[model samples]
Target: MCEIGGGMNFKRREFLRIVIDAIDGKTESIVVAHKDRLCRFAFDLVETLVNRSGCQIIVANQSKNAPQQELVEDMLAIIHCFSCRIYGSRHYAKEKVKAKRKYC
Candidate 1:
């Protein structure tokens, strides 16, 4: 089986390193637990890898030859990141309100 790492866990540089190392060997594929694990920058990553390494990425949770995987993954990543940002903003707003009430 191909070695796997997550973008959520590893920084983009680390993810790229892992991918490059995997491609340097006789590995036929790089397996990710999910599509987003491969990259939040899915299109660019795929294009670069396909051009440079010629190794395919297999998202273990995805079906073979899924045509929309890249687009779907990118959209999902955007949504997830946006949600986190919004949640953080809301949390900070709530904390600010509580602090103002306690002090003023």
Candidate 2:
């Protein structure tokens, strides 16, 4: 299953389905072009769970440069996530202050 979103989001339905299928022994194997393509973090944990359930994760590329690229991607994703949260919180704070002013 291909996911357009960043691998950081574990709440994704496709990702969750794959994990459940692997745990249930329904999925024999999961193949990805790169390690981070499967997940950005906690890959070892997932691999262990899959292996325990008789499933395997096949990573086709193990290049030295892959980790560097994955790191860049992960950093960017983290910044974007935090920036969105900060912006949302600022908007909410403004709205709350406005409501208080109107009430006063």
Candidate 3:
């Protein structure tokens, strides 16, 4: 009864595969530690799918001492994404310069 999602690539997530299976009548209920722990985004769509299938979505840590954990994690994910975008653009620019130099 344990599933580990390696990263927040929602489309390629193995845990989401399980959720889809459960929604298709393979399981009775879907329990999670935190909603974002399973997905960084599009949780509403997942919740709707689970609801449409009449499956229960249980939150194990709905009440906690540190409520900022979710906020911090989301912030980190956003920052990581932004940084990667900057890195990729820089990399692409360098590659383009190299290509132009080679052509010239």
Rank candidates by lDDT, best first.
2, 3, 1
Q: Tens digit of lDDT per residue, candidate 2, span 8-90?
A: 77888888899899999999999989887778888899899999999999999876778788689778978987898899999
- Give the TM-scores of the predictions, in the order they appear: 0.46, 0.68, 0.59
lDDT for each candidate structure: 0.65, 0.87, 0.76
Residue by residue across 1-104, what tens digits does model 3's lDDT show?
Answer: 56564346676657767778868977677788877676777778877887788877787877563659867877898889788889999999999999999999
Best by TM-score: 2
Candidate RMSDs in Å, in order, are 5.5, 3.6, 4.1
Which prediction has more favorable TM-score, 2 or 3?
Answer: 2
**Residue clash pairs of candidate 3:** none
lDDT per residue for candidate 1 within 1-104, as digits (tens), equals: 34344345445565656666756754566667766556645445563664476667666786464669756865786788788889999999999999999999
User: How many pairs of residues collide in model 3?
Assistant: 0
Q: After superposition on all CA atoms, how large is the RMSD of candidate 3?
A: 4.1
- Between prediction 1 and prediction 3, the one with superior lDDT is 3
Q: Write down the worst ten-residue block by lDDT for model 2.
A: 1-10
- For candidate 1, the per-residue lDDT at 56 reads 72
